[model samples]
Target: MEENIYNNTYSLLKLIREKKPLVHHITNYVTINDCANIVLAIGASPIMADAVEEVEEIVSLASALVINMGTLSKEHVEAMLVAGKKANELGIPVILDPVGVGATAFRKKGAEKIIKEVKLAVIRGNMSEIKSISGISVKSKGIDASERDIIQNDNLEYGKDISEELALKLNCVIAITGVVDIISGEGKTVFIDKGHKMLSTVTGTGCMCTSLIGAYCAVSRSYFEAAIAGILTMDLAGEKAYKNLKTIDEGSGSFKMKLMDSIFNFNHLLKNIILR
Candidate 1:
């Protein structure tokens, strides 16, 4: 089953690169452009539509749906709920990014509502957010994690446990992303020990990750396959971009473009390196 999952992911990556699945995103303000650009770089089309008036229609036509609660509003949440229900009814894969789930009561409540209302194919978030939703005892400092003290070597064991717990509860794939990424679902767990610290310096990158997951799931049927593929692909791209940046000047701007370029370059190589 694991081999089959990896094979499926590689095939899905190629399919998305060739077919350019249309992704409908009702995402936050931060990294919205990054999400769209990353989608295009990976050979996927992106459409950002949050209007309640057309969210249903837009979702109806999309190949995949991505909901990011990074910058939440009452109106956008309503639109997301509406679009999410339609996607669920139509069997379109939905990827939820509960960005700052533990940041505030509003964020936590909103994330809970969405998870309960939709059968999300995947939920990707940091340790704090994951712990919050899973009923663990991590105090959320703000929209981001303030307590990285507990993270030792990405704490792979804890990550796997948390991922399994959440996946079992939601009956969906759960990915806890940090220095390392842990993805679990369907009684399977995988750890991706890739990615660079440089990625952490950039804002909206995590949201971009959720968008990538959406793109992968748009083309792959297995939730686990898509989640694993998406994380590895992003990590590989980030490492290559970081290496290239060393050759030139280093800054978010140059690094960002190289990230996209590396993704374009690694499209085929990644498929071959995929564990199967």
Candidate 2:
């Protein structure tokens, strides 16, 4: 609702393209490629290396680190710890995407362990995923947010309260991407309701969003603003991508490509879009 929440956001996008910082990722393999390209699309370089044997070395050269538990394993979590710890030691912000964290004990345990061990700059997930991490899960649908758990206009205020509480408790930004993305941290809550519903139909959109956040983290002055910038980019990109499909009736495949194109040309498309 504030002007800085929108008007000042364009500067962050431009800064990312100008700085071109390297982002390190220990993300899931399912959307690893998508995450890398999306970071590149937003004008930051991506260096994805999850091997525990060399994560410390790799993270030393990165400006930001993204840890996604979308596809987790013992070895992957081990590497995440290595890379995450190194990122913290170097003062490199780390962003976590707790994908499917509510679906299984394994993923949940892995996410909790990472949270405890590494000080994250941002934790990006949907309602169910974020609620689960905060010790409250309103049923999850695999990796998706439960319909019953989504934050609608009627529950928007309540959603902001809980998300802010979680951000305070965790000492990091809480980013929940959904019908209306809510970002809360440092006693601030910024909501960006710019995305299309068709975004949920595509796979790895959340992962890509986290990666975009990581890229912004690399260059932005505030993590809260960086989260807003990253999520706003994806949400606005989704709107543009879906608008392109309305005339032809294409599906997710076409939508995916167009989404990337929108991000690739984000500087032009993102101008003057008002925020809620």
Candidate 3:
């Protein structure tokens, strides 16, 4: 099974590089550039278009669509609906990143609306955000997840149960990312425990993960496998980025650049450390 996963991951990586799938993103402005760069680093082209007028047309041409609610706005929400529906109609995969869903009622409502109206292939978020959408009580601090909400060794089983429940309810893959990332869908679950702590220091890492998922889903038919490949790619690149950092202060700055470089140079060797 592990070898099959490795082979699948390698094949997906090669397919993305060869196909260069176009990913359409209706994402937050805060991490827009990082999202685009990450998509390119993963061997996919990115188009960040949230204009309601052009979103439907853009998504029609894209191989996949990613919707993020980090910086929510009325106009952007409408754009997401437009693009997501068009993607669904065209049979293109869609990935959603409900960033900071528990931080504000506006974000929560917007995310809910998107989920209700669109058929998402995957939903990716931090523990707090996932819990919020899942109706599991959780507290969030602005955009960052509360320390108390962090998934730890003791609550691994609890986390898995909640994630699986949410996945079954939503009828889509749910990825709750933290110290140990949990991905649940199709009545099965996966835990990825290979990322470095320095990953939290960089802004837009989560958004980049969503974009990477979009890239993977564009070429792969299975949302579960696409999500696993995406999270593993981010985690493995994060580990390499932290290792390449020279100074302590350079953690965020250097790590950001190295993360992209690592993704660009990703190979089968990096897949060995990814825990299932």
- Give the per-residue lDDT of model 3 (tens digit) for 93-171: 8899998888888988898899999999999988888889988777788888889778777788988988999899989
lDDT of 2 by residue, 1-276 (tens): 556666667888888888899999998888999999999999999998988999999999999999999888999999999899989999999999999899999999999999999999999999889899999856779998888878777778877888999999999999988888899998999877779988888889999999999998998778999999899889889999998886566999999999999999988886745522
TM-scores of the models, in the order given: 0.93, 0.96, 0.95
Which ten-residue region of model 3 has the weakest summed lDDT? 267-276
Among these predicted structures, which one has the highest lDDT?
A: 2
The prediction achieving the highest TM-score against the true structure is 2
At residue 44, candidate 1 shows an lDDT of 89
Stronger candidate by lDDT (1 vs 2): 2
Report the candidate with higher lDDT, 1 versus 3: 3
lDDT per residue, candidate 1, 1-276, as tens digits?
545645766688789988889999999988899999988888889999999999999999998999999999999899999999999999999999888788788988888898889889999888888888897666777767657613346477877787898899889999878777888998989877788888877887788888889999898878788888788778878888888886545788777788878766665657566632
| Pairs in clash, predicted candidate 2 | none
Alpha-carbon error at 68 in model 1, in Å? 0.3
Off by over 4 Å in 1: 1-8, 149-154, 271-276
Better of 2 and 3 by TM-score: 2
